[model samples]
Target: MTAPTPIVLLHAFPLDHRMWDEVAAGLARTHEVLAPDLPVALGEPLPEPALEHAADAVAGAIRATGPGPAVVVGLSMGGYVALALLERHPELVAALALVDTKSTADTPEAAAKRRQVADAVQEAGSVDPVRAMPDVLLGETTRSARPDVVERVTAWIGEQDPARVSWAQRAMAARPDRTDVLRAFDGPVTVVVGDEDSVTGTDAAEHMVAAVEQALLVVVPRVGHLSAVEDADAVRSALADLAQRVHDPVA
Candidate 1:
């Protein structure tokens, strides 16, 4: 008889573990949830139009924290890192929960934008890019209902080390598309999105669910790309469902 495994939460770009405060409490009732911040960005100027290093950075975090395989929950940039973690250390992740993110690489145009953002963050010595970034990342409807969520999210991003912020941008811009990660995983998977999420819509969530035979997708209406914080209840319920699935794969 072994104790239950913990649930692991990975934070999005320019954010630390704080992003999952609501989620951590929600999941704690039944499952142990651990949230680790992404590395603070610092160091050399970002590579032009590329951001592959963040993946490696995230993989290191996963390996260091786990005593055994843990259910991995990742949001936005965190989701990208989760994909890379699964690819690099498959045995460490028992399941994956991807919220408001897709498993695809950046397009050339998207990559270029990433570089521009990195440069701006580096020059300004701030996470303003991350703060302003959500406008495009999340939907307009969300901003209308949950003004606090923006502050919460922006704070997470703003606190980031400018280099970490810049580095994360570059890392994301450089990584390969991860659709295959979804297509290949056989374990329990949860794909959640805010109904109002125009950045990565429900369509992307469904594609991920379809890719993994055992995957489940939950859409939180009136919520935006930051579904975890925007609709904590929806996220909690979904995690509970995922926990049950992991606990009883045959069911």
Candidate 2:
């Protein structure tokens, strides 16, 4: 049998490759998976968080996996980097899965907020911008019942490198609207969002799903921005279906 296509897993902001650990482990049973730490979150010297630079870094990782395109799965900021990857290296993507993310650029107000957060991180040397994020990142059900999930999210936010967090903020602020890029992609696309996600929500996912010619929208119930962590089974199943589509495009 031909080898399954590689799957490149991109993580959300203020978090490292660990966010995808559970999902990746499950997927690894039948596929070659590469979960890369985005440049800023790697705990090394912070590079200016340019979206293109992050894309380039991920592209390099993908290339190292071997020849041919790979399925790219990105969440939130990782979704932005995934779009950037599609922009920078279209031929390297076999399929695309965007979770809890949008294809639009940040609004001016949002950009300003990002700048403010970046400045605060720079001055305080902390990831305080995400201090109260569990409420925003998790849904009512997850928050009320999954204390383990909530604690892990909080700990992940706390362990972030401050300088890298600031860089990630600036990089996100610089991303452009990628709806046009989606419109141009001919490969399969999957847009997944939590029904209760306050960050990007259903409308955002719908917009991208509508833009892509061969795209499907999946709204995971009782979850918020972090669907993969909050509802790993649903996400893992969605990704498995997407991978099947990649292998059998006619189906």
Candidate 3:
């Protein structure tokens, strides 16, 4: 029997571990899977000033498993956390699947917008960003046509904790550019994004592809920001293939 590679899946911001449920189920047959929620309250307050909280706390969850290395997959905020895992917990990350995320740090204008929204949400509610996020993240087509996708996102947003969202926003605003993490690593990497993922689109995946030595890029069609929900089958296939490449490069 082939030894199974450990798979640790990190979810996007505001959403919880459940976001990876379908994809995890697909990868489970061939690998051991761990999915942890990233609620600020659930873990520690999202690191102040930058990604400080992310590297240690989130990556430490995978580290606690006692494995030398594991394939780490993350989406959006989850992708940020995955980069954190690679940077601070290199020994614990054998490979990486960066889904619907970018390697560059937040731009000052973007970071300022995030801070402004974070402030407004503190006074209002996390739901405000949750509602508007789909517009910014998803393509115009997905927003107009996909009701099920819309419903799933609505459910996810409704469940998030406001304080957690507030903290994560600030954390994201302060994170350093991690493009070097991809360029410097000597390991397998895959960058997956939905075809219509405006928030992190083909451009982001292309940047990632250029950086990693052994990397694959996959873009799911007719989907948007939420690939885990919008194009889960595509996501599953990508992860399965990535796991195979990591486990047996020749196979």
Candidate 4:
């Protein structure tokens, strides 16, 4: 029998690999799932504020898993890193799942806001500046109906080191557009977004889908930016299907 394909889970910013706990657990039953915390996560030393650094970490993780490419699933900031990884180390990726993320670089105003948040976080020596992100990161349905999830997201943000938060924010601000990376990749791609994800909603997802040849777009209902956390089942199902396509491209 053939070995199950490896799956690498890259997490969103201001959060750790733990954000993928539920989805990783579900996928691990059928695939080798590896969720590595990005740079400065879990008390690691701060690296240069660049997505390439994060992508290198992911490449190392994939290499450690053994030879051959792994299915890469990245959410939000993770998605940016995933695109970077694809551009820098294409051979390590068998397929990709981009969830609640966009391939385009942040606009000038958005990048400026990120820098401002970073500055505030560093000056305050706390993750307080981004503490209220759940309001924008989560959909109205989740905020009103799933208080536990909202609290969980808030707690994750609180757990991040202030300096690391600043570093991540700046790193994201410095990233460039990678849609061409997707256009060049021959592997199957899955684009997932919460129907209510205001940050990178359906429009962004559609843009990514149109960039790739074999792309699957999944717009999950009643969720928001953190679709994987808000609706793990939907995300899990989509990933499992993507893995299957990777395992049997001709099927």
Candidate 5:
């Protein structure tokens, strides 16, 4: 029997690999799943703010597994790293699942806002500046119905180091557009978004889907930017299906 394909899970910003705990656990039953924390998410000291560095780390993790390519699943900031990894180390990725992320670079205003937040976080010497992010990151439905999830995300943000938060914000601000990279990739692609994801809503998801020739778009209902966290089972189901397609294209 053939070995199960490897699956690399990259997490969203302000949160570590723990964000993928549920989904990873489910997928691990059928695949070789690995969820690596992006730079600073786990309080790792990064020399500079650059998603490229994070992508390099991810590439290294993938390489450590074996010679073959792996299926890459990224959410939010993780998506940026995935695209960067694809551009810088295309041979390492066999398929992609970009969730709650966009393909375009940040707008000037958005980038500036990120820098401003970084400055505040650095000056305060605390993650306080972004402490309220869970409110915006989560959907109205979740905020109202799932207090546990809200508390969970808030706690995760609180655990991040202030300097790391600032570094991640700046790093995200500096990322480039990678739609072309997606367009060039002929591998199967899965684009997932929460209907209530105000951050990078359906529009962003659609843009990514349009960029890729073979893409599956899943618009999960009633969740927000953190679809994987808010609706792990939905996200897990989508990923499992994507893996099947990757492992058996004809099936």
Candidate 6:
């Protein structure tokens, strides 16, 4: 039998590959999984973590995953990088799974907010703004019932390097609309989101699904922005389903 295609996992802002630990572990039994720690999470200096730069880096990592097309899975900021990779190197991707992310560019007001956060990080020498993100990161159900998940997310945000956080903020602020990229992709696409995700909710997922001819949308109930961590099983199932589609296009 042929080996399964590799699954390249791109992580979100201020978080490392650890965000996909459980999902990767579950998928690893039957697939090759590549979850690289993005530069922003490595405490490395990034003058500007532009999506193009990050996408190039991710492409390099995907190329290193052996000689075959791979399924690309990304969340939040990772999704932006994924779309960039799709635009720049579609040959490397066999399928795509985008979780809790949007294809729209930041509005002027939203861009200003991101720049302000970047500025604050530079001024305070810490990711203090992210430290207060639990309310925005988790759903009310997850916050009130899943203390462990909330704690894990808070810790992840707290551990982000101040400079790297600033770089990510700037990079995200500069991202462009990628709906065209999505519409052009011919491979299988899976758009997953948390029902309670206020950051990029059901509407965003729906929009993405509409843009991709082969896209399916999965909504994880009682979760929020960090759906993978909030509901790893559901997220993993979505990825596994996409992996099947990637490996067997006729199936």
**For candidate 1, lDDT tens digit of each residue in 1-251?**
55466787877666788868888897888776767666423235544333334445555555666567778888888888788888877877788899998888878999899889989988988777667866765567767776777777766666678877777778788888888976888889999998888777888788788888878778888878777877778887887777677778865
lDDT of 4 at 92: 96
Q: Is candidate 2 or candidate 3 better by TM-score?
A: 2
* Model 2: CA > 4 A from native: 40-45
What is candidate 5's lDDT per residue for 95-212, written digit by digit as tens? 8999999989999999999999999999999989999999989999999999999999999999987877888899999999999999999988999999999999999999999998
Compared with the true structure, the alpha-carbon lDDT of candidate 6 equals 0.88
Candidate 6 C-alpha lDDT tens digits along 145-216: 989887888898899878778888898999999999999999999999999999989998999999987788
lDDT value, residue 81 of candidate 5? 90
Better of 4 and 5 by lDDT: 4
Clashes of 1: 9
Model 2 lDDT tens row, 81-137: 999999999999999999999999999999999999999999998888667788888
Cα deviation at 120, candidate 4, in Å, is: 0.5
Quantify all predictions' global Cα lDDT against the true fold: 0.76, 0.89, 0.80, 0.92, 0.91, 0.88
Using lDDT as the measure, the top candidate is: 4
Per-residue lDDT, model 5, residue 54, is: 84
Candidate 1: segments with Cα more than 4 A from true spot: 40-66
Ranking by lDDT: 4, 5, 2, 6, 3, 1
TM-scores, all candidates, are 0.87, 0.96, 0.92, 0.97, 0.96, 0.95
lDDT of 3 at 188: 82
lDDT of 5 at 118: 98
Candidate 6: residue 79 lDDT (0-100): 94
